[model samples]
Target: MREEELSPGEPAPRAREPVFLLPGSVSALAIILVLIQFASTMVLNPDGQNMLLYWFAFQPLRIVASLTDPSLALPLLWTPFTHAFLHGGWEHVLINVAWLVIFATPVARRYGTVGMLSLFLVSAAAGAAFFAATTLLEGVYLVGASGGIAGLTGAAIRFIFQPVLVAHHPETGERLVLGRRLASLREVFANPSSRYFTIVWLVLNAAVPLMPAVIGAQLGVAWQAHLGGFIAGFLLVPLFERRLA
Candidate 1:
């Protein structure tokens, strides 16, 4: 069962909240990206210019530059929060949207909207840091919300492992405890239709790096970014999602 539509054993619904309190904060990120794409197209100069990185994008060098060069420092350095909203193309935006809708809703329901924002920002930074660290050895630019979505993937893994006691019925004092079952994650994985797709995801990730290495193609996947993002969420989600017995 999806998180929003809880099982028959779970708690009943509550009153409506404000609009900003969205179930998936990643949905907001997706909307922001659409705006960014439109703005980039309208404003981009074709004279071999890179305004996206210089002004709109998050520059890793800026952090180092801010530490050493006082002149390079801007008073308002809130670009990191904005960077994930900017993407290279429709493909980049669509992929993030797909990932967000698939996993982020459950994450936000468990942790709330602010917590979702934390996963996105921290995961993005973690991914960027990994990218930056690797570029020191071999230069490459990392773009897109794959890293943020990877964090959600990691969080989902942890969430699925919880011991959920689902009680049912009330008036006649009846309750059937599923009692620490695999109802949560199994609902998504224990399906014949999805088995092949899950295998392809893992296989593609494993094979992408080898493709570039084997074919002498300079381009390769950001395996490190995926790794970093996953680690961040796997480590951080428990801190945000705390429930008393």
Candidate 2:
């Protein structure tokens, strides 16, 4: 009945395409972040560096001060989204880039470029909001892409562990499928991979706040922002995911 039945002598076909590298959007984002950080650190003067942070970094004190003074409100509004693009140092950006490539690839494939962008913006804002709500410290400047990275990680868990449905190709007998279903929070935890990841992530977050004294270094982990971004990504991914046919 199938066309392959009449072509038994023909050579077998290849399997479905696999992504061996980072997608365009994710790669571009990483490059842009690295370039900006490079420019800020190497090319810019001390004043320029301060100016960039003043204009872009999310500052909780400024947001609160803006309540009484209207002029500071613009930075407050934009800083939440802008801060995700900036980083503290080389190590900060590299770690974020790694996480972004790993988790964002699947999200980008499933949700498309626009969806990924939206997720980044919303999650970044949520991360900033959570940090502001929890921290009593004034003049705190939050910078880096970790919130967005955590977001992608959270979003990926929605469907990454599910068993993909496969069908045999008529010509080559290669297996293929449309996509996997989005799993609920409970279902996600039931899977071993997701369960372990969630537990470890929580443990790390809880432990990070105590690392400064233990390590004898000033390590501002911003665990609150990470938690906020993760929660936002986990809850909001369903809205961004395309409906399966």
lDDT of each: 0.65, 0.86
Q: Largest TM-score belongs to which candidate? A: 2
Per-residue lDDT tens digits of candidate 2, residues 1-245? 65654376787787878675677898888899999999999999999999999999999887667779989878987999999999999999999988899998999988988888788888888899989987645788999988877888889988998878667788999887868888888998899988898889978887887887799885678888898898899899999877765
Worst 10 residues of 1 by lDDT: 179-188
Q: Per-residue alpha-carbon lDDT of model 1 for 1-245, expressed as tens digits? A: 66666788898888887775446465676687777777776766754226565554555665556677876546216444455666777877787787887778777777778888789778877877766665643423456777777787667665554456767666766876543332233543564433444455556665666786688894546666676776687677767756533
Model 2 Cα displacement at 238 (Å)?
A: 0.3
Once fitted onto the true fold, the runs of candidate 1 whose alpha carbons sit more than 4 angstroms away are: 1-24, 47-49, 61-70, 73-80, 137-140, 161-164, 168-208
| Each prediction's number of clashing residue pairs | 0, 0
Q: Provide the TM-score for each candidate, comma-separated.
A: 0.68, 0.86
Question: What does the lDDT read for residue 101 in candidate 2?
Answer: 90
- Please report the candidate that would top lDDT against the real structure: 2
Q: 16, model 1: CA deviation in Å?
A: 14
